[model samples]
Target: MNINDLPAEMLIEIFTYLPEWDFLRNARHVCQIWKLISTSPILRQNVELSKYMDSYAYPLKYFSAIQLYIKKLVMHSTYIQTFEKHHQDVKFENLKSLHITSKVQCTWWPNSVFNNFFSMFPNVQIIKITPEFWRDAENCLYALSQFSIIELDFGYYGSNSFGTMGKLHDLHYRFIQFVQCQRSLKILKIRASDHFAEDTVAQILEKCPTLTSLNISGAYVSAESFKISTNALALTEFYMKSQSEFKDGDLEALTKRAPCLKTLNIEGCRSITERGFRHIALNCSHLKKLFIGELDSNCVTDVGSDVITKIAKACPHLEFLSAIGCSKLEDDCIIDLTSSCGSLRGINLNGCTNITDVSFFALADHCPLLNVCEVRNSAISLKCAMYLIQHCKGLTKLNMSNCNNIDDKNDSELENMLETQSRNNKPRTNSSVNSKLDMSSFSMHCFHSHLKDLDLSESMHVTRTLATKLTRILPDLISLKLSISADIESDEEWFQEIFENCVCLSEFKLSTTTIQRQDYLKL
Candidate 1:
């Protein structure tokens, strides 16, 4: 097929997948036809007028040319001055969505900025307001009355500290009063607020009938905080994190409330245990993604793993499961999970110390389609890792960092050998060894041929030889992470040599080591 023979529609579809419109920056100058397509209104529909646009003198004048094409416009802090001046005149009549984000301080915006900002996009369907554009409660209430927004993301920007002032309740009430009138709101994500509308949940239920995903994670909402009406029972994905009063029965009760909820992320509820999660598995069997990980503490014990086993058996469609810091999960739990959930795709068992080689064997025997697996800071040895590499050939991302027991051993040579190879008494061949004495050829040559992202950081086992042996065989490796393990002898050249051999290495990280940024330039 000739390069220029493809139709314009097909070419436009291909261009949409290209990385950040880089090709068009110069390709527009290639030919008249290309330039016309590049500058067309259809291509410039979702334009972002960010701080980088300051590089141009008159961004407003530039945007005015494509006013008819403006569908989604993102305005950052840099465009604030020019925005405030000519926003009323800049007419994007067909604008459907508007995104406003900034990392500037709470007091950065002029009191009238948001009021004026909303007036500019009065009829936009979707409005995303980052926490940076905060105004006084009085100004906020009057300014937002114009927008009939369907999707609203009024959340945090890590800037505002919702202080524990004497008027805390007043602040909550004011917030509710401001947003309660948004009857057409469909999706609401409120972040970094300790109090999620103790009294306003009913008002929201009344106002927003089509609410689907409610992320009150930053609100610090408790089991007792919400007074959800029956009208608000249509939520699909509900995420509530960092609750002080979250108890064990919340899930059992929550399933009854949001019966159709597909994804649940109750992350930091210290009071929740296996009992509630079991109920979640039994009742909310339609769950696709469950994140009940106790990030700060190892609160989700074997009971939680047991509940997960129930979830695997009951909810076979569970795609992504994260149990980070659930330390008590042993090999049997993994066995049950792998056996029951043939659909298991990605699992994060980081910080689970009780898991070992047994889970690896079970996963290898079952779960052929499993792709992303992270077992960092676990008791799994490198010998079992040999089984994983050879058996779980489909895995794209594998993280076994901090498995200190995985010392520089070629046990994987025999450990990972196929059953047929062992019966014939044939040793694994290492034909492509550049130099027999090369330290890179120390570890077993080629095992995980399909792995793209590998993290062996903090494992004293991956010495100079093992790193070389591992890198030589893993031809598909794109991103690699390595850290200096204790007592492992290595020089700067060894590190350089390992990287030089990886012709496809795209993302590299060498942490807690003497490797300098300049060494990367050498490769």
Candidate 2:
């Protein structure tokens, strides 16, 4: 069959996967059939105006065909500035999602431009204002209050300049007014800098009864913030990360109000201890995803294994858990959690230096659905890798960066042992050797075909031989990250071989510790 002989429905479905720029710039101009299919409502559902802002020299009719069918629109400051000049007649009645990206700080827009810009999208329900986009919080909040926004995301960069306490108070008042206008607000993500006080959040919780997801970061949340008169019956997902003032009492109060919480992220909140986590395990049994990683502070030493084991027993339905830099965790905690929570799909145990191969063994034996595993800066060895490859058939993304135990010597030893065992057909002397042989045999045959993303960065012992073997085994890799050390002989040949084998690879990140001029040129 010819390539273009497919039905229109199939063609539209294929074209729908293309990016907004590709579909508008290249795919639509291919042939008459493609052009007709490109004009379909499904293809024109998302219209990004920022990409076409540079082509303002084009006629007004160039965008008129897709304007009416656009359900989501993305614009930038440059596009909004010239919107009145170039596309004044463009109106999208069906637009429901409006994303505004800004590079330079915009304080305020002229009344005429602001009115015309917002009047075009009458039914916008989701508004995403990116970081450093607006400096004047009052103007931004007042303008947004005019629309009945259901989901509003004010990016992490709160206001660049709230010069005085009075101005910050005014911005907070304006934000509360904006939340008051949102009668059906379901999701609200805001960077709570100086703009949100305890009273402000309490008022918002009291007003927005339909709110299900609330993400407030970048500020100190007092224990009294979640203390309100009415119960948050509809709240399900709450993320209060990096709040220095958020303590165990705050978590307990919030859990009492939001009893139906499912996904919670309290990472970087150094004040939250094991007591805070116990509150979650007791109140929020339906939780599926939890992130308690401490990214920044070095003094965070309260998180231990006992509380995590309690959480595992309480929240057995947890699917994803991230405990990055939680150095207090040992093998027993991971073993208990993995054995208890059989449905776990992804786990990040980065910087848990005490975790050894025992945790991986438990993961392989208990968690069959494990797909994404990150064990950076740990004490795992090649035996653990072999076990995961042999058992976890669904494993796709694995990160073993900075793991000093997985080196060229261990790889070579394992290969030699397997080769000798195959030649002699003899029973292994020890149980560990027998287990290694079994896993090695399975790994040799299976080749881990499901893996697409692999990272072995900062492991100085990774040599070319192991890299080639991995590239050949996981041929469908989309992202591969490696770090070069002084011991590796040649970098060019292995990189070329990797590129040839992994045909679907798109992102390749390479770093080197020892930089020689000749090696640099070869790379």
Candidate 3:
């Protein structure tokens, strides 16, 4: 059947499959029949498009192709003026998302200029305004409150005057009062200069009862005195980073209040203690992931252990736990963890230096279903780590960083699965059915094919041959952390070769002082 013969609904279905920009452009060019169907009010209600403009070759040709796919477009400072060069008969009503950020800061942008910029898209529902231009058009933000916005990322990049207590208070109060109170604001991301305004945040949560995701990263949460009692009944995800103000009882009270929280991350909240963790484990039963780092020394003691142990027993569904830098943990506490919460899927014991090989073996014996383990800085040698890996066949991710004993030989046998092409030759099939796979041997690359992420940082004995073997065998390797190592320097070229061949890598970290950014960026 011809395109014109299809029904509006069928055409929309086809068009929706096309990206936002392409769909709009394709619809506009078709006969009036297709245009009407594609441009109908119904089709425009829920769709969003983001068109990118970068300084590559063929600006005109690129813009033409992009204009066809452009639903919402972002223009950097350099590209803003150039967009008009490729201007066509496109309507402002067709656009849905717009972001304008520049490298150079603008002092002042008049209200008319700002209005005209957004006037291009009357149906805008998502907007991101950077601090680079916030000063120029602070009042422009007041106009944004009118849109049907559901997602907003507002940045305020000003000089750091967060030293004095009085200055911080005033800065906090000003922005808190300035945030446009929108009932429809469901996802809000803000970068503040000083501590987050507890009262203001509370007000925001109270107003937006439907808010599901909140990210307040790199901010001092002075809500120490201001109790964080969430009114966001629909809130599911909350991330608070660098919460320097989360002293002692603050986090404990906050978690107790957020009973329905599914994901709570207070990364770098140094003030949080065992009391806070205990509070969360007890109250937030639905928490799927909890990342509490930089706990105080006192809280890592026996008192903290008792609280967390109770929490582990109470919260039966805890899956991912990142208690990094909690040095108070001993084998006893780990034993309690395995016994109490046997259902754990992933655990990160990055800086729990007290944990030995014995502690991990205990975990391996108890938590058979554990798929991922990150024990970066502990007493577990390559020998004990290999044992744990052999037992936990289901594991795909492992971390043995700072464990000085993880030599090249010890690493190979830990994960040594074979990856072979299927009958079709195009597809690869991995098998654990081989009988010759020795579990008793202490080899580093024992089950290599099944291994996805491996951290052997500070394992000084790692050589070029071992690194190459790892990359060749482990086709699914996603992350490899080998920082502060002696072997990395000896075979720098081999390191490069491995990274180049490991096509599936998404995250990587190296601590060599000599490696350049271009070298790592090749991955």
Q: Which candidate is the best by TM-score?
A: 2
Q: Candidate 1 — which residues are off by over 4 angstroms?
A: 1-57, 93-97, 103-112, 132-145, 156-184, 195-197, 201-207, 227-232, 296-304, 390-394, 414-449, 485-501, 513-523
lDDT of 2 by residue, 402-505 (tens): 88787666565346434544564534222334544544565244444567788888876777677766766566677887775423455555555667656666
lDDT of each: 0.65, 0.73, 0.61
RMSD to true structure for each model, in Å: 7.0, 6.4, 8.5
Q: Estimated TM-score per prediction?
A: 0.77, 0.84, 0.68
Name the runs in model 3 displaced over 4 angstroms: 1-77, 80-104, 160-181, 195-198, 224-232, 295-303, 339-343, 362-372, 387-396, 408-448, 463-475, 478-523
Best by lDDT: 2
Alpha-carbon deviation at 196 in model 1, angstroms: 5.5
Residues 436-461, candidate 1, lDDT per residue (tens digit)?
Answer: 23323333333444677889887766
Candidates 1 and 2, the one with greater lDDT:
2
lDDT of candidate 1 at residue 61, scale 0 to 100? 55
The residue pairs that clash in candidate 1, if any, are 193-219, 440-468
Cα-based lDDT at residue 80, candidate 2 = 59
Name the 10 consecutive residues with the lowest summed lDDT in model 1: 430-439
